[model samples]
Target: MAKTDKQIAQEVLDAVGGRDNIASIAHCATRLRIMVHDKEKVNQTEVEDIEKVKGAFYNSGQYQIIFGTGTVNKIYDAITGLGVEGKSNEEVKSEGKKQGNAFQRAIRIFGDVFVPIIPVLVATGLFMGLRGVLMNEQILAWMGMTPKDISPNFILFTQVLTDTAFAFLPALVAWSAFKVFGGSPILGIVLGLMLVNPALPNAYAVGNGSAEALKFFGFIPVVGYQGSVLPAFFVGLIGAKFEKALRKRIPDAIDLIVTPFVTLLVMITLGLFAIGPVFHSLETVILTGTKWVLDLPYGIAGLLIGFFQQIIVVTGVHHIFNFMEIQLLEEFKYNEFNPIISAAMTAQGAATVAVGLKTRNKKLKALALPSAFSAFLGITEPAIFGVNLRYFKPFVCGLIGGAVGGFLASLFHLKASGMAITVLPGTLLFIKDIGQLPIYLLVLAVSFAVGFILTWFFGYSDKMAEELKRAK
Candidate 1:
């Protein structure tokens, strides 16, 4: 008999060593992220055997189980029905800080702050992609118009649709950061607004030499924090702590009035005069360092990341790279990270495709085909867990394919205008530079071909399925 979602959730919970062993639970777009009190108590083999569970793995101190998109929500709801409390990302971050070392905690916090903000950015990115498509000379000529003849109102509308969020990105970041740090989110928005006030020149303009620094207190430098990340984050942290500290001394009667007043007064000054400049420089240094590494000669750095990327995905911490991708878009206006990572994903998908075609095991074939499709659509957990990682050899083969693709990508100087979307849909990114699109196709083709051929040649055998009992 087929198991219901409740039973699947129950089985998952049981396979995770019961509700008592679970520290916290949450779900993302495709997986259940469970923080466990004891990793050793969890039976991975049993979890993999459970009905409706596609795959499972441990990474960033969380036990992640794949149920696949729409279904994961049902199972998550079922788990909640069983009296297990599902925590928010903030709660998960708080618990993660307690359980993780410094680096792990940092990664958790970064994910926490940015993940919530991504939906808006993605919507905006899609609009930007649309605008890119509309601006294409070929597209324009096909539409029987030229750039000079295009409607100004349409351009203005696209500008607002595509650019407004990124222009005032610090506000969104500050709002999210304050929530992550345990503060009133409304107050965080208020502070974020001040950081990007119209009175101050915009950060983007400052970069183009259209805006100059305004000195405060006769010596301290101040500029708008528009589109910046570090400044708002730092201010939100200090502001949250300041607001909490103020609430302690002020009497309850007048606390609301006085606390916000004092907190904003002190924190805004700190942000403008001290915190903003310092952290902006730090953000620059970090961005510079990343650029330096990613740009290494002969695509050496790209080769390394491509080879190990899927290995990192198995650990479930691969989502953290989105932050790096977004930072690339914000700082450099182009993402070099996506091409290399997409190469890795395409290779994984290719390996799964080869396995599906070569395997006589009907069960493995059923899993491999859809997972490969998902990987091609920029989701890889299914491919990595449902097929590649289990066989081990195929995953390594995929890495080799990815390394070759990344080298070719680097050699061709591939770039993307946005992040968060990849593979087939990522073709939208190269719309403005149609010449680069074919080069990207070449990278994907090479990656896919290498992974498919390698996996078909050595990744599996008919006897192996019987040995592993994966045969239907």
Candidate 2:
């Protein structure tokens, strides 16, 4: 017999300690994101036992119950029907401000704003990687063709596929930020377009000295904000507030006309002179700071991130890295962090497998093994939430394994030409320098071996499986 979504929803509410514990609620692609007033009141193990639930984890002050994609929407609706109010991602986020320090809350807001937009970036990155593969010297040479041998139409097709998103990325960011900040999304998009308007000097061109910035009012310098995230986001936020404020004052008959017009006029001015350059400078500083860390001695930077990246993933805040990776791919044309991050991820999957093999409990084995396979395929949430995080020692073992792999990757100067994908799918990113394929494989193998061996020897136990047993 198939269980109804309403039944599942009821189970979920009960498992999370009823409506009293829930301060605010929302849903993402695969998880029921809950901000609860009392974490201690929830029965986490029981929640994981639900047939439809894939995994569960606490991250960034939210109790995230994973139900995989597609199924989550039904469950979300079921809960909403049960009379528990569902909040927008931003509204729920506002409720979470009390959970962490200002810095943590800022990071959470960044993740919330950007997570919904990652699929587009991922699609763009995959195409970018594929284009690289098509143009690889080895691939072309093997096909008995030189670079010039490629058809012009095919080249144009690839360019159109890979380049368009990055060219208009600010608009996407602006639209998303507006939605998050409770503004009119379309108007925010218009503001973004205005920043990249053709009349202003193109940002990339101005950077190379091929175009000049125009003078606003013959005093303030104005340049296009193409590829600038902070400016678009900040401007979109202001525009939303401005429009809302205007809506309050204007007469109903003329409100729609006056509000958008005034908001756009004021925002375009502020975006060009006040917000754009300042935030653009901040973006530069942020990227430069990250690059400086990446350049540090003997792969120490890799060591740190490779070990703890999964910890971040567990919190579900890993989407914040999507923006950074996209920025790297667009500006630098390669992703330096991919190899290290992949190593960490592969290690997590490996650790899960080790626990699966070592566990005497049948249910634990069933969950751990499949989660391990998913992790190997470059999806680590199943492994992290369902298996490794459940057994604390396995998570630590994975961390140690990733540090070693990441160190090796950084030491060898290995990098991915793509940004989003990793592991087996990530291999495409190395086709340009196919000789590095073996080294990349070696990184994965080493991570897997270390994680597997350590976990098999010392990771899982009766105590760890105790809760899982109840869930089952």
Candidate 3:
């Protein structure tokens, strides 16, 4: 019998020890993120067995249940209606921080600040990709025109699509960071704008020796923080703190005017003079170190990163990669991390496919196939928690597949034009260069084949399915 939404929600609540035990409830993309008061009262196995529950696992101090996209919202609504209050994602994250250690909390913060900023970047990347296609020499030749024949105004229009986001990227980052840190987001945007004010020397121009930095007090070199992440992030963080501190002391009558004025002035000064210079350098150093590690000889770096990336996901710290990806795009105009991680994602999905093909249990097979499809679209929690992680061996096999795929990625020097999107949708990132699409497809194919083959032969059998069923 098909279970109604209410039934599913109630079962989920019951499975996790009911309304009283849930300290907080939220949903993110594909999972029901719940913080329960007592882990001892929750039944992990039963939760996985619930209708529409793809899988369940404890991560970052929250019991996350996979329900896929679209469906998660319905379930979340049903759960919230049943006499249990629903917390916003940020509020739930706050509750979760009380339980997670330092590293987990930091990763969660990274996700909170950066995830909202990704859509604009993805759209810009797609625009860049499409522009690349339109401007391709071969494509232009087919249209009986040379590159020089294209209108200057049209070229400028393309630049508007491609360059605007990164040009004002600090504003976006600062706005999001301020909101995350509990400050006035508008103030953060204003502060971020000050960092890239036209009066200051452009960062790219300074890098290229076309322009010089302005001398502040004859020694401090002040330049516009164009395409910079850390400066904007710290400015937002400190600005939020400063604003909150001012709010406590300011009188209610003039609080609104006084708080914003003081916050913007102090933050802009610190951002351009103190925080901007220091953190930009730090961001550069970090990016340089990351590139060095990723550029290790003979794809060894790829092998290590690919094999262990999923394990990091299991620990719920993988959002830390957002910083690396963002920095890579800012520094090099290309993201090497995207393709490597895409390969890792592909391998996990392939492993799930193998499980679906091999499992004789109807219920398990039903769960595995759709989860694998979801993984190909670049959501891996379903495949990982529902299928790959169940047998352990398949998970390891997927890691091996990912390592090989990543090794090939490095050897081929695979790079994506953007971040956020991966696997099937990630193909759009490779469309800029003529041969890149084929190579990217080849990498995914190899990852899938290796993952599927290995898991099929050695990672699973009918016996394990029988055992899992008996245990249930």
Regions of model 2 farther than 4 Å from truth = 1-35, 43-55, 65-99, 217-219, 463-472
Model 2 residue 7 distance off true place after TM-score fit, in angstroms: 9.8
Tens digits of per-residue lDDT for model 2, 187-250: 9889989998888899999989999889877877788877778888789778888888888899
- How far residue 167's Cα lies from its native spot in candidate 1, in Å, is 1.2
Stretch of 10 with least lDDT, candidate 1: 463-472
Question: Highest TM-score among the candidates is held by which one?
Answer: 3
| Global lDDT of model 3 | 0.90
lDDT of candidate model 1 versus the reference: 0.83
- Per-model C-alpha lDDT, please? 0.83, 0.83, 0.90
Better of 2 and 3 by lDDT: 3
Q: Where does candidate 3 have its weakest 10-residue lDDT segment?
A: 463-472
Tell me which residue pairs clash in candidate 3: none
Tens digits of per-residue lDDT for model 1 on 98-150? 66566666766777788888878767767766788788888889889889988
Task: Identify the leading candidate in terms of lDDT.
Answer: 3
* Order by lDDT, highest first: 3, 1, 2
